[model samples]
Every structure is written in structure tokens, then in C-alpha cells.
Target: MYDYDQVTAFLGKWGPFQRLIFFLLSASIIPNGFNGLSAVFLAGTPEHRCRVPASANLSSEWLNNSIPLEERDGRQVLSRCRRYRLEALAHFSATNLEPGRDVNLSQVEQEKCLDGWEYSREPYLSTIVSEWDLVCDNDWKSPLTTSLFFVGVLFGSFISGQLSDKFGRKNVLFLTMGIQTGFGFLQIFSTSWEMFSILFLIVGMGQISNYVAAFVLGTEILGKSIRIVYCTLGVCIFYAFGYMLLPLCAYFIREWRMLLLALTVPGLLYIPLWWFIPESPRWLLAQGRVQEAEDIIRKAAEKNHVTAPDVIFDPIKVQDLNSQEQQTYSILDLVRTRNIRSITIMCVILWMVISIGYFGLSLDTPNLHGNVYINCFLSAVIEVPAYTISWLLLQYLPRRYSMAAVLFLGGCVLLFIQLVPTYLSVVSITLMMIGKFGITSSFSMVYVYTAELYPTVVRNMGVGASSMASRFGSILSPYFVYLGAYDRFLPYILMGSLTVLTGILTLFLPESYGAPLPDTIEQMLRVKGIKYRSASKSQRRLKYGEENSVILKNTSL
Candidate 1:
């Protein structure tokens, strides 16, 4: 078994570079956060000031004359007054009067004393309605765009995975980062909603590549024992930065466009990734590029000032390489095996439920309180504790139990919000926020868990499919809000039930705690019964050299 000390040493030596990769990866996806929340600023009612004609009489007689006496109470008084005022004023023709001539008394007075009601309303309502031509215009189009973007992400993931497999993870990362940065900036300059949606899709496509490449590279570079910890921690810190930066962006740039521009600016900084990040040696060897792999190994050895030994990189001979196959896996391969199919179904369902509930709740931040900024900040603030707890729980609890408990707790909290009275809605929202934290934490855990379940060759594909499914949930979430589900917390009820069910379902998956990463489906199936092949005695001695000399000396003695 791999020891924690060895993993820590490896991370200590290479952790900075690993952190850098994750940072860039996280920055590239910040636009997702923007897209996720931009509706609050973009689609809300705008404040407008309009004046009513002054000559119009809004007195008791007008109300009494226009409306039946029985209907002339407080509720109908305003409507009756407006109707009579408009009717009485219609006979006068002010436009026909000569220039400088005295206008009619009704026209002059009505113009002077404006009494009409004016309130803020959504500005782009007509345009949005005409564009989609839907019954309601509750920003469903934005999530539609989001959904398309995720579809693009599915394609991008596959393409980027192939490119990373063929060329290298680092180069793909740099290229994808550059593309994401460019398109993300272009989103700021988008003139129309269509243009913005299109650009968002493009940005999402490229963003997926950055995430897939960085994750694969990080996992490949790390030692086996701590891979899950590093991957999870990397994402946790990324979200921590996201929560910190998103609020700052919201504060500095009140306009949604300006905020998006600010988010895009950081992506440009990742361009230097071309020079700093290195290709994964494991990938090179998997592709039969032994010379290239050895060269990379030599550079890493040089950087650490460790000597390299000559060895033939044969897949069949090396225990680590034994599972390497030349064939590339496709989406269909995910469902080809019963076990992979089960994992895929479970992951997809979990992803969909988490995303729908998590994002639906987060997006309701504007409706939760008067001060959207404060509410959004508070919501993000809660995530910090959730992540901290997740880190601790993941270390101690079985993966299934941890995932289940969080999901169930989150669901219960969401359900509890519904029974509370409107006066206590804030308390309910706070509970919902805590639930959001739990769901978000569970969402992050799914990534690590899924990665652990799938082999290296098909890992990205499996994750990519889950990403696509989650986006589908995002697409459907807007409709939940559109249907006034958020108004009475019905969405929360549905999401909560689904989450609890997902938690129960998680109990069935085989525990991967302390297990070696299975490099093939066959290996994954035989995890308990079949012992993993180990490196030969001579090979181990040759690889370790003087570092293991003490152990060898002790054994000999």
C-alpha cells in the first residue's frame, strides 16, 4: 500500500505547480459562476419614472360616475378614477390649437397635474417574450443558453480528451485556456441576447477542456494514495476563490456586463500556462511514446535532483503499465459493461439532482431578500464551512456514507423550509442556504468519487457525461423558477426528495476507500477478489536505490 508520507513528499516537491494548474483551471471556469447568477442583474425589473396628465380629475365623483357605487371601494377607486378621467378629457383637441394660443382648460390642467401611477418593471420583457414567444418570460432563455453551452461542453470534453491523449495534457490545457479567455471576453462585448448566448456556449465549450485537462494532469502527476485528497482539495480551494472573487466582482461592477468583463480578465492571465505547465509522463507512456515519457521523467528528476535509471517502458512488463491499451474508449463504452453502466447511471442521477436543486436555490438569492448583493454574499459565505466539513468528513467517513448523509441532511433542511411561515421565511432561507452548502459539497465529492471509479482511459468521458447531465438539470431549473416553484418552495420539495433518494441509492456502490485506482473495467470488477500485480523485487530495488538501502540492509542483517 502507498504510504501518506510518500504522497506528502511528492506533493511537497510538485505541489506548487499542481496548485498553479488548478488555479488556472478554476479561473477558466469563473464565467460559469457569472452565467449561473447573471439573471439576477439582467432580468430583474428596472426602475422607471412616468408622469400622468394633471387635468384629469381623480376625485370621488369621477370614481362614483365611472364605477358602480358598490364597486367604488378602495380596491376599485383607482381604476374608476382613471377611466372617468380619460373619458372626460378625450373631447378636447389641443393639437389643433395655433402656436402660442391658449390650450383647452382640461388639456392644460391635465398636462400640468400629472397623477398616473409609475412603477419599475422589467425593461427587456417584450423583446424577450417575442424572441422566445413563451407564456412567461422568467429568464428561461438564459438557462436554455446554459444548457446549449453544456452540450457544447460535452463535445469539447471528448475532443479535448482525445487531444490530451494524443498530444499532451499541458499543451491542451494552454490552448483551451486561451480559447476560453478569448471567448469569455467576447461575451462581455455581446450586443444582443443571441450573440451573448452564442458566445457563452463557445466559452463553455473551451472551459470544459481546461477542466478536463487540468484534472487529468493533476491526477496523473500525483502519487496514488493522495490523488483523491489533492483533486478534492484543489476544487475546494478553487470554489473558495470563486466565492471570494464573485462577491468582489458583484461589488465593483454592478452592471452584469462589466462584471462578466472583470471575470474574463483573470482568464487572460492564464496564457502563461504554455510556458509553466508540463505534459503528463503517464499519458506519454500510455501512448507508446517511451522516449518522450523518459525525457519528461528525466526533467522531473533533474528538477528534484534525483538520478534517473535506464529501463524499457514496456506495458506488459511494468505493473503500472499493464492496464494500458492502445484503443480509445467512446461514450458507448460507458454503457457496454453492467458495472460501468451502473456507475454512469448513478453518477448522472446524482449530478442532475444536485445541480437542479443547488443552482435553483442559489439563483433564487435575489428573491430570498431585498439586498441581492448581501444575500448572494451570505450564501457564498456559508459554502466555506460546508467545504471545510466536507474535507474533514471525506478523510474519516466512507465515501458512500459521507455522500448519503450530506444529501439526506440537505434534503431535510430544504423540506423543513416549506412548513415555516412567511414571516419566518428568512429562517427558512437560511436553512436552505445550509442545504445548498451540503448539496454543493456533495456535488464536489461526486467528481472525486466518479474519477476514482473510472479508469484513466475512459475517466474523462465518464466525467464529461456527468457534466452534461448536470447541465441538463441547469436547463430545466429555469422552468422551475418560471412556474413559480420558487415562490412557494415547491422546487425545494421536489429537489429535496430527489436528493434523499440519491443518497439512499449511493449505499449500493462498492467502497473505493484505500483502493488502488483501477486502470480498467476488469480491474474495477475484480477489486476485492483479485490482488493487484506488484512490481518485481529487482525492479523495486533498482527504482528505490539508496533511499531503500537502509531497509535492504536491515532485512539482510
Candidate 2:
């Protein structure tokens, strides 16, 4: 049977139809750039201390002393979670002698904040922490909120592939887009943290789901040559566009609710894209809807002002499409062979560590000493070059070496951050941004490299498991950022160490650049780079009707 690409060769690779799909689908990814990182501003913890009550009956001088001083990062500052017992201080004021010199000020009792906190309005006028009072004993809740969203991302990553496969990519793409846009809008009116968290989870589910759909849709529709560019520069650069826009929006919109609102409204304009972007013909043909697939190609040919073959799909019998259905493989198949198992495990570790550095560094921006807005914007802006460099590395360098190099670079830079003086914030911020750049570049490389590492039969499932692992990394990342509260260098030290470890692990995996991708586990054994381990029972191939029973799972799930 003729392949789908051969049948549709008349439409050409870079025609008007492909360009439209490329831009519109890439355009859809813009919202994810900001939405994914919105928590940096939305959940920001501003400088705050215990609020003093007017009834304390203290003058301005005594009022300034209401808050007890505590040591933080080796500096004396007003305590955030505790204060001098205001009534005790009021009573002490009655004595003629000053408390510190005449009486022992240490004798004054310190207590947990009974009154609310007073947060500095700079940077963010209102954040979720300020609005909901998620500080002191409740301070842990702030990072938990970010973790819950990633929990939603985990669920979404696991299921979106299955949903997209069963229902078709276009359907899942638009459906998730609706879920993301609708839930994001609803979050604006949340009266309590519970309500907001529930909605944000749904938004997270939608956010990654739509991104997966658009990514799959574009890659499937465009020709093999353009797919690389779309994946590297096209998709990544546009996402950077949205990321660069995030700080700009946050800078202008000081309120958390308004920042969310600004980030979500752009999704509405993408509604019209449903009409413009056609269902992928490759997906249609796989579904055994030959005529629908041909019709789409016909329309694409018209858009490109070219002629398609009169019977482009006739060579592909409807029955041949069922072959993909017969070759079902599950996640277990990943470890069924030595070469594939090693690849899968390595990919998972690399993906998880990349996510740890990616999100950990991103969320830690607010804690960086320089201007938070500039720090975040520069973080986003650096991705353009990182992605471009990743594309170059993909074209010119060995996949394993490139992946390891970026990981090592990012890890080393982060590891060095602890050595910089805290007062040299410019130096510290520069190191952090450099770490972000290396990780960001590694992030793109892993996506492409993982796709190349797996055989076509179990590619999507392999990537899905890896992506699920990534959510674990993301969920833990906020806590890594939370480590800043305990010691500023802890998050960097941990993420950097893990990243460097993964880089060393990448060296053991077979390189994929300039090599034919394995189509089956049998095919992988013959590939040049894989150094086979001692064969075991699991690696033995079954030689019976049971082999035929293993159905091939769909790709890019």
C-alpha cells in the first residue's frame, strides 16, 4: 500500500496549506508559555510582617518596635511570623525606664501573629499569598498550590495521549483548549483557596493537553523535513514569545487576578483557529477514513494552487490500515528488550532531571536578588537562543553528547551560584540565567532526542511515561523552590547535582543523530551504537501466535 506521504506528494511539503497549519498551531502554543509560569507572579510572597492593631495603645516609636527582630540569612530583620506580645509591650510602656537598657527586653514574650500580615505592595500589589494569607504556618500552602497544578499536569500527560489516539488529535486539541480557557476564566472569581486550587488543576490539565495536541497535530500534518524546524525553532521560538510577554503583562498588571485574566483572554482569539486548521490527513488515513483523508489533501492542494492526483489514496486499501491496530504494544514493552529498556530508563531519568532544573529555576526567580520582573523576562528571553542552539546541536552534533553537554553546563552553573556573594546580586542573577539557558536548551533536546530514541511502535508510550515522570519532577520543583526559605542555596545545590548526574547518565545511551530510527525492537539490536547486555529471558523473542497478539500502540500519545 502507498504511504500517506507518497499519495499526497503532489501537495508539496511547504505549500500554503502547510504554512497555515504551522503558524496557527504554533500560535495556539503562546498561552502555555505564560500560563505554565504564571505562578511566579500570582503566588508571589512579598515582604510582609505581622499587622499591628490600633488598640495596642502605643506611640509611633513603640509601634515600630511591635515586631520582634529575628535573624534571616545572617541579617537582623523584623520577624515575619512572630511579634512582641503587643499587650505586654503596651504595659511595659507604662514604666518610666526604657525596656532595653533599664529592664530586660529579652524577658518580653514573643507570640505567633494573632493579627494578619502586612505585605509590601511593591512588585505585586496582590498575590495569592497576600490575598489568602498563605504565610507563617500556612506558608507551605503557597508551594503546595503550585504542586497541585503539576498534579493535574501529571494526570493530563498520562491520559491525553490515550484520549488523542481514541478520539483523533483535532478533537482532543480543541476540547482541552476549551477546558484551559474556561477554567482559567473561572479562577478569577475564586473566593477561597479550595475553589481556586480545584479550578487551577483543571486549567493545568487543559494547559498541557492542548499543548500536546497542537504539537502532535502540526508534526503529523507537515512533511518530515519541516517537522524538525517546527519542533525546534517554530514551536519553541513562538513559545518564547508568549514567555517574554508574561513579565510584560505581570509588570503592568499588579493584581494576581488581573494577571491571570490577562494571560487567559488571548486563548479566546484562538477559537477561530478551529475553522482554519484542518484535521491531520495522516491521522485520518490511520483511522481508515480514506475518503476524508483524500478530501483534506484535495483542499490543501487547492489552498496551495496545485493539482493532486485524481485518485491519490486508491493504492492504500482500507484493509491495510488495520495493520496498525493488530500491532498493539503496552508500556511494559519498553523494558521487554535490553536495548529498549536501557533507552527508556535513561530517557525517563533525563526527562525528570531536565524538568527539575527547568521548573525549579523558573519558580525560584522571585527569590533572586535582582528585580524579579527583569529576572523573569530575561529567563524567558534566553530561551530563543537556547532553542536556536539546540537546533544547531541537533543538526551538527551527536545527540548523546549534545544532551550531556547542556545538562552539564546548566548543572555546573547552578552549582557555582552558591559561591557568589549575596550582595553581588548581578553576578548571582547572571549565573541563574545561565543555568536556565542550559536547562532550557536541554529541555528541547530531550524532547527531540526521546522521540528519536524509541521505535515508532512504542514511541508515544515511551514519551508518555517519560512525560509522566516529568510531572513528578515539576511537582517536586516548587518544594525545591520552597527550599529557598530554609537556605537560599539549597534549591540550586539540589537541582544542579541531579542535573549533572543525568548528564553523566546520558553518555551511556546510544546516539541517534544521523542514524535510522528503529522501527521495531528487533531492528534496534542491529543498530550500531547499542552495546547489548547479556541476553536474559525478558530479551528472548516469543516464536508463536502470541507475537502477533502484541498490538502496536499509537505514536505521540
Candidate 3:
């Protein structure tokens, strides 16, 4: 049977048709970047204090002084969750008050704020925190919202692949895009935190579903040479650029509702793209819609100014199509075989580490040592170079080596952060960015490596399972950030340790570089040579050393 890549070579390779699809699909990812991390700014808690009532008739000095000081981490600070019982204090004055002689200030009764809280308006004019008093006792709600979003992503990852395969990639792509855009807009009018969180969950499902559909579609439609570029530079880079735009958007649009609205409005730009992009030809062929697939191939050839054959997939025998349709697979298949089970487990762990480290650092931007806007922008910007470098390494190194190297390096940088002096914040932040760059590069490599590891029958299932693990890790990321209250370096310490462990585990997976994608459980476990289908003797492959020896032998002759 002819592989999709071989058939695609005739249609076009890195041509105008392919370029348009790549850009349009990648562009749709920008809104996802914004909505995914919007929680950082939208739910950020500003410096706040318990609200004091004016009915107490206390002087300006007395009113400001009413909130008593408490010792925390060796520093005196005003109480945020509690205030003095003002009825008795209203009668007292500076003349009558003395720390020890007249009244012991520490003996004053304190109670939780009866009237709401006052928030600082410096970084944000409005946020979920200020709008609903989600501070102090309610602070837990902020992280919970972010976690709920990823819960939706977990469900979406499990379902989107099956839906895209049953229907068509293009239809699923558009449907998810609509879901993302519609729910995002709905969030602006939310009457309560519960309503906003529910909408955000639906939007989260749409976001991941949209991204997965685009990724699978691009991989199927583009030529082999261009597929890696599409995944890394085209998809990941565009997503990173959108992430960079987020903080800048938030910096100007200080109101949380308007900021969210601004991020969502970009989804409208993708609507016109529906006319320009076509369904994946490979998927069409799989569904036995040969005419529709052929038409798309011909259109691609015409746009690329190349002459295409009368029937691009003419070599596919009837038996081959039947074989594909007859073959059945399930989640059980992933673990039913020893080799596949090992591969699936390792990929899951690696993906989980990447998610926690990547998002743990990303969502913890406010805690970093710099202006939050600049820190976030820099964090997003760093991924661009990391992804580019990943593409370059993919061309030169084995998949396992490149992935493990980056993961290990990222972990080291994260761990080393603990040694940096607190006053030398610039050094610390730079190291954090470097650590991010490493993990980001590994993230790009993992997607490509995962696809190549699994056989065609279970490829979608394998990637989807790995993605679900990633979403699970992302769900845990907010809690990781929340740990900073005990100690600022705690999140980094935990993320770093796990990343290092995953990096080591990544080394155990068989190298996919210069190797065939196994089509059966037997082939996956036993076959270690060749770069194509190994079911036939003609497809037998020579090792790298053997190929080198062959060249030397020919030269000597």
C-alpha cells in the first residue's frame, strides 16, 4: 500500500497550496493561546486590605491605623483577612491609647471583615479577584477555575480525535473554532463565578479540540518535508507569538472583562479562512471518497504550478483499502502489547512533565522577579527560539537524544535557580527563561516523536492519550504555583525534579529517527531497522554503520 506521504509528493511539496493551509490553520491557534492563559491576568489578586466602615466616625489617621499589624515571615504587614472590632475602638483616641500603660494593642479583638475588601488598582482596574472579592478566603477559587479549564481539555483530547476521524478534519476544526469563539464571548456576561467557570470549561474544550484537529489535518495534508516545519515553526511558533501578545493586550486592557473580550474577538478573523482551506486529502482517501481527494490533489498541483498524474492514489489496491477498514483498534490495544505499552507509558510521563513545567512557569508569571507583563512576554518570546532550535535538531539528531538533552538541561536550570541570590533577581529570571526554553524545545520534539512511534491504526489514540496526560499535568500546574506561599522556590524544585526524571525515562524509548513506523504489534516489538513498512523483504533496512560501510566499499572499488 502507498503511504500518504508518497501520494502527497505528487500533489505538491512546500507549494502555495500547502503554505496557505499551514498559515490559516496555524493562525486559528492564536486565540487559543490567549484564552488558555487569560486566567493569569483575569484572576490575579492585587494588594488588598479589609474594608473599613466610615460609620465608626474614626479620624483619617485612626481609620488607616484600625487594621492591626501582624508578623509574617519576619516582616510586619497589615492584616488582609481580618480587622479590629471597631465599636469599642471608635471611642478610643491617640490621647487615651498607650501600648502598655493604658491599653495593650495586641489584646484588641479581631474579626473577619464584615464589609468586603479594598483592592489596589495599579496593575489592573478590574479583575475577577476585585470584582467578586476572590481574595483571602476566596483565593482558592482563582486556581480552581484554571484547573477546571484543563479538566475540559482532558475530556476534549479524549473525544476530539475520534470525532475528527469519524467526520472530517475540516468540519471538526470549524466546529471547535465556533465553540471556542462562542463560549469566550459568553464569558463576558457571566453573572457569577460559577457561570464564568462553566463557560471557560466549554471554551477550554474548544481550544484543545481546535488545536488537535489543525495539527492532525496539517500533518496529513502537507508533504513530509514540510510537515515538521508546519508542526514546529508554523503551529508552535504562531501559538507562541499569540502568547506574547497576551500580556501586551492585558497591559492596555486593564479591565478583566474587556481584556477577555479583546482576546476572544480575534476568533472572528478565522471565519473567512473556512472558504480558503480544504479538508485533508489523506482523511478523504481513508473514507474512500477518492473523487473528493483527487479533486483536492489536482487543485493543489494547479496552485503549485506542477503537473499531477491522472490518479494520484491509483496504486492503492482494493485489498489495501479493505485491510485498513477491517482493522479494529481500541485503548486496550495500547497496553495489550509489551512494546507498545512501554512506549505509551513513557510518552505519557514525558508529556506530563512538559505540561507541568511549561504551564507551571507560565501561569506563575506574576511571582517571577520582574514586571508581570515583561516576564510573560519574555516567557512566550523565548519559545520561538526554542522551537526553531528544536526543528534544527530534529534534522540532525535522533529523536530520543534531542528530547532527553533538552529535558535534562531544562531541569538542571530549574534546579539551579535555588542557588541564585534573592537580590540578584535578574540572574534568577534569566535562568528561568533558559529553563523554559529547554522545556519548550522538548515539548515541540515530543509531538513529532510521539506520532512517529505509534503505528497508523493506533496513532491517533496514542497521541490523544499523551495529550490527556498533558492536560492532567496542566490541571496540577496551578496547585504547583499555589505552593509558592510556603516557599517561593518550591514549584521550581518540584517541576525540576520531575522533568529530570522524565528526561531519563525518555531515553528508554526506542529511537524513531531513521526507523520505520511499525504497522503491527509484532513489527513494533521485533523490527528495529528500516525507515518504511517492514512487512515485505524488499523494505529491509541497513543500519547507519552498514550504510557507511557500503559507501566505503563502493569508493574503494
Candidate 4:
């Protein structure tokens, strides 16, 4: 409804109905955090070496020497793929009775694990890497698994909007939840990497679909004042809760399958939400299901102990009061003017860089040189403060400089991690966490700042294009994390370099602290602080039919 306030004014805000939608929708977002990052533990590669069977009858010295050591991080460690030729170890030369002490290991011929491999069980009982033997030359497969999921996410974003309008938001929301849960559980039974990857892709699709659906639904149902809270603290914070729970679950259940199973079963609890969470009354009204919309609104009014007007919305008035010819805008519109073009380019780069940094830091948890569980938990827990601080900054600070400062802070600390001694892993992890905090805050702030930068004609299109750029960033994120296999600091260095570059670019953007939203490119480029200087608050209020678009900026990760 263009005039939804007319209805919500009687329905009242913060009442039982709004409360239910707020908490239930927020709770529904919890699984996404775990689902998104579960790959960190599920695909974790444990320390492994060639498995020398007892049937070889090699002596203790020979058995110990069977697996060769390689230099990594300035220290020798057991080779994951290469080993001393077992044939030579089984039949030692008469001149050299003991290996390593007498014979130089460098002279020994090395070969791939001929007998298979044995993995260390100190941290993980099993992971997909161990199960599928996705190590050695195939180590890239581990990160590829995470990237494929985001590929599914990219496809999901393409279709979710059309599907949401085709089917009701509530319908698609629960349907996606079911898909996430069902596929998540089914993933444990995957016999090969191919099967798990396929299921994971579909689950990724559902994960994002529901998140978008829930976000849109909340915007439609919640009153104007509460929608912002629902967008920021409600959905985002609960996602952190689920993220926090993931490490705790993985800690107790070291086996990847068990951890995966434990993380997915909670979806069943949200199944009952179908009854408690109603369809968006506004969607029903738009669909011309006015009776249905009225029914939901009436229920809400009664639930809130408020009186509803005898006739909430007249059908004739709805059709005649605010009807206008719809205007269409495409990606081309974003670059139609000089200001819009510059803004679009900058916003896309910023959004993509933020996605890469955030997901890169998250997937790097296992490689943080400490207890993976604790590191993962710390990574998840920090988001709460990151979000709170972001909310505070957006309220008081100028949008342009605050975003640049956080990105600079995050990037600089990540680069500093390279300066610290590798042995001082605590310092490295601490710096990495600070980087996550900055990226996370930037991630939240970018949506608000970028949306304001665009004219209304292409506002949604501007954000959509930027968000699509972000999906590509996320798809490439695991590979950035994969760089850690070569050097522990490599991923951070790459992300930091890009992040710092993006931060520098942020300085070019015009400040939008209190500027009224521009409806056209000329308006957007107009001199600051003209008529809008004083009327900014009233002029910036969300207009009818526009509040629903806020969901377009929902942070899916």
C-alpha cells in the first residue's frame, strides 16, 4: 500500500504483532551465520602424512623416516603429499643402517603417498578434506567448495526477487528455510565431493533466498520506526548469535558430519513460525487480496489492543488515490550523469571489496594459528559490537569519512599482521580480528551510504548492481583464504592492499551526512546545503511505496 502508514497508524507499533514479527524474523536469520561459515570447519584440512602399513616390516628408524619432512614457515614439518620412497626405506642400504642420522634426507627420492595417508586427529576427527582426500595437489578443492556455495548465492539473488513477488514473501521464506535445513542435513551423507558440492550449492541458494525474503517481509509488516531496528540489530545481530553457536557446536563435535548435523537441526524449530508470522499485509494488499490484508491487519490491531477503523482501506480509493504510470530504470541509468557514474563506480568497488574482506577474514579462521574453534568463536562474537558501533557511527558521524576511517583501520591492522613475528600468533589473530571488526562495520555502513548517494530513479538498480559485484567478491573470497596455504599472511596482505585502496577511493565521495535524498542525477550533484539543509529530516523521511526497497540493502552474509 502506498499509504501503509494510514493502516499502521491504527495497528500501532511495538505491539505484540510487531514484536512477534521482529523476534521471529530475527531468529530465522540465526541459521544463516552458521550455514555461511560452516565450511570453515567442515572442509578443514588436518595435518596429514603418508600412511606406512605394518606389513612392510620396516624398523622404527625406517618407519619414522618413511614420511619425509619439508620446510614450512621456517621449520620442518611432515610432508602432506610427498614421502621418502617407501621401497628404499623398506630395504635400507648396508652402508647406512639408520636414516636421517647417517643418510642425508635430501638425497632420498621423494614420491606421492603410495600407501595412502594418515591425518592428525588432535583438532578434527574428520573433515571433508580428510574424507575425500582433497589435499596435496588437490588442496584447492577445499576452498573451491566454499566458492561454489557463493556461486549458488549469486544465482539465488538473480531469481529471489521475481520469486518473492510471484509467490508470497512468507511462502518463499519458509520454503527456502526448509531447503537450507533439509539439504544441510543431507550433506552429511555425501559419498563424494561432487555430491556434497551440489547439495551445498542448493543450500546456499536457499540460505540467501530466505534471508532476502525475511528482510523484505519485515520491511512490509513492521511499522516505520521499528523497521530500521529490525534491519540492523534484529537480523544482523541474530546472525552473529548463530555464528557464535557454530564454533561451540564444532568444538563439542569434532567430526565434520556431526557438527554439520548439529548446526542444521535447529531449522525444524522455525517450522512452527509459519503460523505465528503472517504474510505481509502490504503484499496482500498489493496483490488485490484486500480481504486477506485486512484480516491480518485486524488481527494485528486486536493483538495490540488497539481499535481499527471500520474500513481500513477502500479498494476504489486504493486504485484511484495514488495510481501513476510506473517509470523504469536500468543499469545504464546509473551512468547517465557524471555524478551518478562516479558514485556507481565507487559504490560497486566499495561493496565488492567489503564482501571480499569480510568473507576472506571469516574463512581464514582455521588458518589463524590457534584453536580454530576459539578463533572462529571470537570472529563471530565480535560482530555484535561491530554492528552496535556501526549504528552509533551512522547516527552521529558523517557517512563518507566514518566509512573510510573504518576501512583504513581494518586494512592497516591486517597489513601490520605481516610485521609481527609468526611465532606471535596471538598478535596476528588479534590484528585479524580488528580487521574483521572494521570490514564488518564498513559492510553495514556501505548500504546506507551508497543508497543515499544514488538518485531515486536508479537507486535500487545502483544498489543491486553493487550487490551483484559483491557476490562475485564473495565467490572469489575462498581463494583469497586459500592463499594462506602458501603464506599465512598472504590473504591478509592481498585483502588489506585492496581494502586500503578502496579506503583511499572513499575520500572522493561527497559527504551525505544530512543531505536529502536526490531524486535525479542533477539533484544529487547539486551544491550541498541549499534548501535541504534545514528540511533534511522531513525531506529524508521514507516515502510511501519506498520503504519496501530498504530490503534491497540487506546484508546477506
Q: Please, what are the lDDT tens digits per residue for candidate 4 over residues 458-556?
A: 887888899899999999999999887788788989999999999998988888898899887778853222333333555557553366565555644
Clash count, candidate 3: 0
lDDT of each structure? 0.64, 0.87, 0.85, 0.88
TM-score, one value per model: 0.70, 0.93, 0.89, 0.92
lDDT of 1: 0.64
Ranked by lDDT, the better of candidates 3 and 4 is 4
* Number of the candidate with higher lDDT, 2 or 4: 4
* Model 1, runs deviating above 4 Å: 1-139, 287-299, 302-343, 451-464, 514-557
lDDT of 3 by residue, 1-557 (tens): 56767766766577789888888888888877878898999888787888887777776756867788876534699878888878756766535564345666688888888898988897889998888888788888989999999998988887888899899999999999999999999999998999999998998899999999998898888877788788889999989988988999999999999998898888888888888989988788778787888888888889999998766776356237645655678899999866787788888998998999999999988888779899999999999999999999988899888998999999999999999987889999998999999999998888889988988889878987898889999999999998886688989999999999988888778888988887876666322332443344543344655788999999999
Ranking by TM-score: 2, 4, 3, 1
Specify the highest-TM-score model's number: 2
lDDT of 1 at 242: 63
**What TM-score would candidate 4 get against the native?**
0.92
Clashing pairs in 3: none
The true-versus-predicted C-alpha distance at residue 203 of model 3, in Å, is 0.4
User: Tens-digit lDDT track for model 1 on 81-142?
Assistant: 22223444333232333212442332422221134333333322222222332112234564
* Candidate 4 deviant stretches above 4 angstroms: 93-96, 321-323, 526-557
Model 4: which residue pairs collide?
Answer: none
